[model samples]
Target: MDGYFPGTQSGPMDTTETFDSLVRAEFSPRTSYLNTASNGLLPARAVTALHEAALMRAEGRPLLPLHENVETCRAAYARLAGVPADRVAAGASVAAHTGLLALSLPPGAEVLTAEDDFTSVLNPFHVRGDLKVRTVPLERLAESVRPGTALVAVSAVQSADGRLADLPALREAARAHGARTYVDFSQAAGWLPVDAAQYDFTATVAYKFLLGPHGAAFLTVPEDFGGLTPVLAGWVAGEEPWDSCYGPVAELAHSARRFDLTHALFTYAGLRSSLELLEELGISAVHDHAVRLADRFRAGLATLGHEPLPAPGSATVSVPGLGVRQPELSRAGIEVADRAGNLRASFHLYNTETDVDRLLTALEA
Candidate 1:
């Protein structure tokens, strides 16, 4: 993996230098892609892995062997999230995992969450009419926790305004109230160091900052989590799925693997490749580089008489003025998102200072 790319260095390099090399080695210069919050651009190595997986499938290879790729992906995600590999479960999407978690919670429970969080986090609990759900501002989340609160669910970073949640404080408050904590790391996982160990449950969509294909995601649950019942039980979730088919009683896996749903095997292979690249580059370096670019973009927007939202330590920057200009900017080969009436530009390792300049130039024009 050291020399997987041509001219790749053997040891660590400066973050900027590594990013420049990554831009050259991984991505094509077709457009200034600053929409990682919406969908990430897959690196060349990940694409190659996907291609090879497709070729194997075309050659009539069994999908059973690819199950190992799922474990490999789970381990990679666990490493990134600073949790044990056994605590991780592969899924098709954040919604699937959240729904499964919702089913595991006590009936008629009270849940607290942020209104600005992604819909997947809120919808699952909402659809379960038995639970009482309350939405509050992210800054007030810690204070909003009460004695009756059964679970607190929120995103590590708000997708709408790029606001990061005070996860440590929130976790502490939830724990004080004897409530469990759940975090959606879809926007923060690759670019921000989110320790999944801090929360009782954590979920991520691999297609975003993880830089993997769509339809692949994972969830992490605590080792001692009780009330372990699988609402959408499948043979794969069983401890001995092969033997369970012939038995009268079904025994689920003791670990978080019991929560896993069926997923695309090739997607896991692609995710493993991207996760390995992330590990090699180092998440802290990626976070710093992305934050620097976001800061630069925000400062430049401010100088141009636009106010970008203040979101420290976030790769995404939201500019209200640029929301209406998104279409024109897209025509100029600049990619960004108009999320919830704010124009958002999300930076990643493949982005550079030049890309920020291009975005500022497009906005100014």
Candidate 2:
């Protein structure tokens, strides 16, 4: 599987130098966080922004500038996702935006998704009394589309298996059934390529893979879906947030800005800094770096008599024999996550092939 980048294989690049050295070699040090999608290591730009935001907050400045920052970030993110600024919505988290979208749908509408969908997806459908919820295996999503399916929710990369879904095919099936498509891009946004205009709504958590702080997220709603209401409506969604009286909810901002829960200057400042780091690093190259490292990792694990997931082009590697591999690899400073009966190792720009070899050699011992 292509984890980092498929069809791009050179030799192991140096990783022993300081993290700062690696960052300067490319772009900002923050851009090289190998665990960006998992733990959200902050980028340098975001760090600076957070500092500025914190200082402003300490001085008791108004928080409205954060709303403007969200708007600016939305426009910048739209460019990255190849969509217009109006199609994006900045929010505190994916769950917050999902709540907004769920409110807009019919009361009794049906929501379909894979059983492996992330936890936030269950919030809207499971809590509602009238919404009909149905879930099948991840493999069945492609063929499960039918009438009455108001929305087909999915994760672009399954957090459980790190498998990348066939987005185009899913989009086609959802469109055929007149169902809206919602993708949780928390796992796919930074490590891989994503386009929001292709789907009805794509929610992204900036903390994951984007190398930003927590509580920063974005939702992309197509112009056609403008009728959807914001469940968490506030002064932000109104035509003029400072307006004394509420009006028609400001028509939902005509952009992702409608999803903003409240103005959060410090967090937004941090996230914007991380976005700037990504802009400097060139995502195409970043994808290549991650794929190469993950490929080597997978190969090394295989040589040690462990089998990874069967899919191709996925960065996640699942190693069996936990008792044997975990302790040995841990001693070598290699950390991995365990999920769904598999040992998961996620590779990103900061990882190197040497790190892979080190883990495999530990297993050999």
Candidate 3:
């Protein structure tokens, strides 16, 4: 084990000069990776941590540290979300957490949603079948809230085109109508400067902008657990998991941990390091860096006589009818996504102006 792990290195590893320095230190993308909306590249630290974790499992060493990694990731995400750790529940998917939220609603309750939002956000309500699911254009979500609307469920950032929801306006609208809010932060949390505290219920997957691996998702609920029953609660949701394991859970946890599901321990081990890297970079700085890159891409597209989807301040830029070029671009070592006939390219803190220009040059060719 001693030889398997490297000696601990301290300090920022020379990150003080600029974000570019940190990016240079942590990553070495072989391509101009412009597809964070798909999945993020892991930092070197996270990859190394994961490798060591797997080796520990192979050697049958103590895995108790893996559990500790889960709690560290939970707390770090709470800080990123601007909420107390006690209110956040760690889970595996937004859809699973939405099942818990769906159970809290009475039959026939009206659920307002955005049209074409990620299915992970929409499908859960549809599965309930008894509730009324209403869809409106993304721009009309806030104004669509009305009396009898039991819940307002939508993604904070549209996954298809990267348009941002009007969060402040949406929050006010939900309050005015007595409707509760559930926001999917899958595409926004890491670099969008969002506050989970602003919404009653928020769920985010860490693999996207957060740069964690898959199999890790987070749900934040109000102090009262939003009146939702933890129908899927297992031994982990008990006040004392060890003590309650043999019985019907003598006492459930009083906090959001009541909804706790067993985490993917090895993934969590690596995610702990990923979250540490994100916290070090600071979300505000990441936001500016990503949005700046996206805008630069959009301007380049305009000069080439192609217009992108009208996403004013999003970190994702999607050019309409240009998706046919995706194959050629990929062959040239530029990574991007083509979603529903739109050429989609999302930027993150690790990307640079040079990456943006490489993609533009490829698209022009």
Please list the Cα RMSD from the true structure of every candidate, rounded to 1 decimal place. 3.8, 4.9, 5.5
Off by over 4 Å in 3: 1-18
Candidate 3, 98-190: lDDT as tens digits: 888888899999999999999998888899899999999999999999999999999999888999999899999999999999999999988
On lDDT, the leading prediction is 3
Q: How far in Å is the alpha carbon of 18 misplaced in model 3?
A: 4.6
Candidate 2, 339: how far from true, in Å? 1.7
lDDT of 3 at 281: 75
Q: What is the per-residue lDDT of model 2 for residues 191-210, given as tens digits with 9 covering 90 to 100?
A: 67788888888888887777
Q: Global CA lDDT of candidate 3, please?
A: 0.87
Ranking by TM-score: 3, 1, 2
lDDT of 1 at 36: 94
Deviation in angstroms for 88 in model 2?
Answer: 1.3
Model 1 global lDDT (CA atoms, 0 to 1): 0.83
Give TM-scores for every candidate, taking all chains together and pairing residue i with residue i.
0.93, 0.85, 0.95
Clashing pairs in 3: none
* Tens digit of per-residue lDDT, candidate 1, span 1-365: 23212233322455445645765787775898899999998989989989988988899887675778888888889988999988988888889888877887777898899976899998989898888899998999999999999889999998988999999899889889998888999999998987999888889999999999888988888887545566665766778766665544278887787877876888987888898888878787777778878888988988999998889878999987567778888899999999878999999887878888889987776
The candidate with the higher TM-score, 2 or 3, is 3
Superior candidate under lDDT, 1 versus 2: 1
Candidate 1 has its poorest 10 consecutive residues by lDDT at: 1-10
